[model samples]
Target: MIMHDAPEQTVKYLSLLGQQFPNQQAVFTEIINLQAILNLPKGTEHFMSDVHGEYEAFLHILNNCSGVVREHVDEDFGDTLNEEEKDNLCTLIYYPHEKIALVHAAHQDSPTWYKRMLDQLITVARRLSSRYTRSKVRKAIPHDFAYIIDELLHTHPDENNYRVRYHERIIDSILETDSTEEFIYSLAELIKVLAVDHIHLVGDIFDRGGGAAKIMDRLLSCVHQRTDIQWGNHDILWMGAAAGDAACIVSVLRNNLRYNNYEILENDYGISLRGLVSFADRTYRGGERIDPLMKAIDVLLFKLEGQIIYRHPEFDMEDRLLLDKIDLEAGTVTIGDETHPLITSDFPTIDPEHPYELTPEEARIVQKLVDEFTGTDHLHSHIDFLYRHGSVYLVSNNNLLFHGCVPLNEDGTFASVNCEGTWRSGRDYLDFCDHIARRAWRDHDRDALDWMWYLWIGHRSPLSGRNVKTFERSFIEDKATWIEPMDPYFTLTHDPACCDMIMREFGVQPERGHIINGHTPVKTTSGEKPIRADGKLLVIDGGFCTAYHPKTGIAGYTLISSSRGMRLKAHEAFRTVTEAITHNADIRSETTQFAAAERRIMVADTDTGTKIREQIQDLRMLLDAYRTGLIKEH
Candidate 1:
């Protein structure tokens, strides 16, 4: 409504369209007079218009003549319009036409007023659609967003409705609940099991889920209907989409099918679900129509919340800013009125997996997308980067968060973490960890990768950048168990270094405090072994996130306390623990499809495993390194 100036150019073009149909019959007959015009049989017509009886435009048009909106425009077919054509392509439809069509619609959401318009348009377009070439039809339509119900059926929400973010991590119960209501209902159960105060989101809350719009509306309705939310990758993307950012839009288009501009929507113009129905309604009348509402449900899911669930136990402003930095890199920023970013820009398309180098134009586009990436804008947020929301780090009173180990000089002495809090040892430990985490993401940095995985395997020399990426393949694929040095694509395996870095950089390491973290998804132990080669490091990321595992359960998160040390717990209140864990991974029979329970990080338990203890030692190495660093600096 705020954008309703209907620019002068739009007025001029709309006037021209009206002039084309001077008389009511000129408009009405376009439908019934199909056979002679578009090469159809005697029974059909073309150029249908389900006007809102008054010949004036109304909101009902969004539903009545849904096809050919901005999102669904195709440039080549004469259906797609440029930025200018988009404003100028309005038509004159009478309300009466849509009311009569009501009888044809199966659901009530297609109100009586809109139905009449649809019915008439369907009859006319089918008969005459043959006459006009696709080029002409495309030019006439301008935007694809007009076709709402049409594309929904064509895309077949049933097939495209699988998961995207919730892939490998297994969380049962998440897939069963259909509506947002059901999702919220089960969420409480997941939270109880996980043991968190509030959920954190990374961003991207739109464009890939059922009832995405409604879910978003509900999430925002905290004051309206009262709901809790954690940002996710999709949410920030939605912000950009709603604000109409072409960069973010294009990235999503390349990935998703339901909203792809080129392949599915028949144009690179924009989205047009309503326009799709109108296209079908006119082109193929009386053909079994797919359920548009069902399709809309899928469209709504891209706006889901609670995906990255981070909670803060307690902290001051200065510390919060540090938290923001980690989230920014993770791509979970969330600033209001912010445009979505192009994820492919700053980060390599596949981070060393890219087949070809990008040209300047392509690179610019990527940069534009990445530039607009909005990190969290919350008063408490510490980060300031591109689009991010879901990815979060909690700093509870009892828990500490850090990324790397204390630094080690070329001679292999220790460098102090020197960060903050009582017992400042954690701070020094944190620094060395930082070095490894960064190294792990770098090329041929086996040491860092291995450190993160808590595995002490040495790497072959001259590990090429290409080879480093190859080594990381298993780590990214998350099948570290089956991974071997021979596979060497660059191991996603583990980098004990990252944890140390996070702690020292953010000062999450405390002398006497426990720690909680995400990011590192490696099993705390391997075989029955304890190889504490490098240093003492502790990693608690037992793979609580679905982005890693298709079958990761709900309670992968851990809790460490001096009273009983640390233990694993489930996030029972998180709607579908399975859905939460799986993120969007396919959830077949949980029994057969899922296995390999990543053990929770446990301290002081017989089952803690040698790797866990080894990790603890690696964490300690960070402190030692930091201390040495302080000594050298002095």
Candidate 2:
């Protein structure tokens, strides 16, 4: 792990490692050999950051020729009793010395991805001519590879008609056009054909679009085929919502299964639409239960993961393991974890006996989402939930990583009030109108769960309880002044354009990374862009499926790094910021202008010119909306 193993050799080894192994064990074995051949003093710390779901990468380091992992091939090490061998099996791969430690790191804190990759490694080994691990060492067998179709509904739905207002967005090569619709559709298609070594979905497979049902169906089919990498919160919201609306959903499920030629007896199958009722009924059958209580508590703490929903079988005061597994305390809900947040009585429901109150519509949405998740996925409360005990702390490294907010809670309060408030760093703000929506849905007065908090942290509603100007003004009074202020839904695209503004309030290292985030919704889709909040931040949320277009091949992200310097680039889908902004702006201008023209006719100062002007206005609106939203110029 010595930092200096001849940078050239290290680079060459990386290249070979990338090529030689299609799984983790093979790669790690190579790493072990490489370290031995290099013969560097042991104990040097080597950190593998964010390996993610890269199965081959994992394998390449674990089992390969003359590679670098830990100790391997007892024959290669000579079986000589050395002090290092006596102490640690892993460290014996090297010369055995202090000042060196090899470690692996991930952006999101969860070992589920690592475990899944480990499974893939085992699978690859099993399929290969040579075995990577001894037969005695094999403890687990993977069922299948994960095939995630992100934003499935947003993709090119078979039902899509060539009805886009923009000429460039008319089907073929719409990736270049400027519509949100196009962006989503394009991401969906592109992900299916990405060049990455591996692909995985981190969650949010539903909501905010007309194609929710489509995405859901596609996801179900995909899960049936591949491993479920990330079970995001949107999935939980829907599961919760479904619980209150299972009757209709169950009917839909039954119809869908029947259409697929899958027959069920007694309507109690795991994949049944009435799936939720039979399951819920079992968990709540008066008193005694065979499964963990979380299995029965599916109606609360809704979640989706491992292609299943884990509700409590029934509440048990002594069974803390089930409760601990439920993740209601303070852990971060990353892509792989199996825990879920608890829907406690601490938060009110719409019922008269509930702790809090909610309007009818808000109540309905929550009920529907919960039920949908549990019924469809069999919501399991057995997995760990988000922000249970983990505190949020900001890191100076890794491109100034921060969730959308300024690291503060939505109520302008200290974020660490609870485990949920624990941020690594940075703040969390309630986006525009989501807080209102949350408030409407929740019995007002309940602190939001991580799912709701995550959604509103950066984006705002046009009707959020607070105003943007006022929100921004708060930052002027304290260290918090560095944060942008906006109510729900009020877009902040233009705020960052007023010359340059400093992002770091306190001092940071020279190596401190640049800031990057995913929160703000897309602006005009054409090229030229408007900088917001003085350009201190860049929003990378291309409405990423779960919102507008889930399954389209138009999804990608902005890459920001100090090593790369201050620049933004899109991958696979939209190619650049100018393309996205210009497209978005053009459409908005057109829509605004058309609405105005329609009204101008009634106020006609000059009736003669009014009709012609209105027609032009309508044309301009139609043209501009297309011009902005589509990525045609790309």
Candidate 3:
């Protein structure tokens, strides 16, 4: 029989593949493994948005895996363990080292207590491990306890009577070796790791709640699991600041001062506010109701912002250049058809002819702040992680995740945005924004750094869906002038077809895909629902920061996509971490399941499954090559 020859590249690729598989036996083994993996249950995806520096809340939710850990405990011990016992077990998994100490204090280091806790924890771990391949579970275990954990999870006492004694002896050994605490800690970690397969942070991991750096530190430690951040406008402001944008740097400082997040800047990131403090003291007097530092930073921010606006006429934010419109003598600023009275007539730094130019003193202070923000290694490391693990948007498992709107016109059409001299809309515009944002970090040129500022507040910016009224709100006493109008996309998204069009534009099947949004808080207090567009879009930002809790009527919203289906959870405010660890105060959450009647989802339906199938095909090809003698194998 005549055999057909393969292309040169195909032959070379198969030859390289043979190096990994080596022989037909190895190829067959891998193919079988891949096939088995394809039939397993799909891993759960946990989606959160607008964490907004609520580090304690975010950390607790993360440790609990959005209550998946508790659910596991409830499932395994619902009938066996009482409510108090279950709650304690859940708390133990969340803070093992701390909870263990407390347990020792109350129970006097009882061996009976340690042994009971270990058995219960192992049961939960084993249940979670059943959903994953043995190899994958082993990889997630700590290196020091990998062998012990693997054996404990996989070896069932029911397999043989000998195995029963073996399991008991292992637990007894752990108790005798004074390693109960260590073993329990390892089990707790493994349960946490296995509960949630992937974490999707829709956006706004920085700003507001005063512990963004702490939140970043916690996220950085999760090397064992998958996590991705979709950049929010607030996150972009910090990114731009880290990239040396003067406007962005002061904007960050302004917010920190405004929200009283001075500790985050001065203590966490070690950025000195002394320069601004000294400058504010010398610049502003005591009569103003606003803090002197707030007034000082606002003036500096407006000047820097005006400079950027003057350079980029394309930004169409000429109206925001209000310093030029200020009449210092009258203490009023003309804004288009209306003239609003300034809250204060303190314009010591404004030169009538050059309203955007900073005075020599003002320039020196802001420059120092810019240098400090850019030079801080800790700040840079966190921002570097954001750039490494974040993006403009993410399409995972058919759902499109973005921090803000897909800018739309009033007629429910994708809005054309002029990005980098070219007009693009929808996905194209977002792609351009993403490209320029990366350039802002990579090149740090004048234009790119300026683009980062635009992404933070520009009306056309998809990341920032509303025209920010920062200047108007700060200076003008008129509440009417402080209304920041949202983009048409916010209104247009009320229509399901509009959301479907957005999904299709992003190359997702509208019927199955949902747009996960973050920038806007869903006002549940005022009878607003996060699920909108007939379930085509979900706004998961249920106010993670305290400021919006009154408006949103909930602490936060998290989405879970598991093998069963998707669900949205509204979590009540986390009282305090101390309360959680001591009193077992888990964030009381109400869950709303989406399409609960749908068929169970399996690994064969996932993105990872697609890649695995491709691998299986490649291995089959390598096996053929080995049999045909086309490639030699060891």
Query: Mind sharing the TM-score for model 3?
Result: 0.98
lDDT of candidate 1 over 92-211, digit per residue (tens): 121222322332353533333233323323323332333333333333331322242122112222445553222211122222322222222222121121121122221222333223
Tens digit of per-residue lDDT, candidate 2, span 145-235: 1111111112232445432222223322322332323232222222221111112232333333223343333334332122222233233
- Highest TM-score: give the candidate number: 3
Model 2 ranges off by over 4 Å: 1-205, 209-372, 375-397, 407-512, 525-536, 544-557, 560-567, 570-634
Candidates 1 and 2, the one with greater lDDT: 2
Which tens-of-lDDT digit does each residue in 1-634 have in candidate 3? 1123878888889878877889989998999999999999999899999999998899999998888888889899878999999998999999999898877678756898889999999999999999999999999998878898888887765756787788888999999999889888899998999999999999998888899999898889998889999999999999999999999999998887778898989998889888788888888876787767888889899999999998999899988988889999999999998888898988787899998899999989888888898899999999999999999999988999999888888888888977768989989999998999999899999999999999999998989989999998888888888899999988888899888899999889997888999989999989999999889889999999999999999999999999999889999999987788789999989999885626778898988999999998888888878878888889
**CA lDDT, every prediction?**
0.27, 0.28, 0.90
Segments of candidate 1 deviating more than 4 angstroms: 1-197, 200-251, 254-505, 520-567, 571-634
- Candidate 1 local distance difference test against the native: 0.27
C-alpha lDDT (0 to 100) for residue 611 of candidate 2:
49
Report how far off residue 549 is in candidate 2 (Å).
9.5
Worst 10 residues of 3 by lDDT: 1-10
List the candidates ranked by TM-score, beginning with the highest.
3, 2, 1
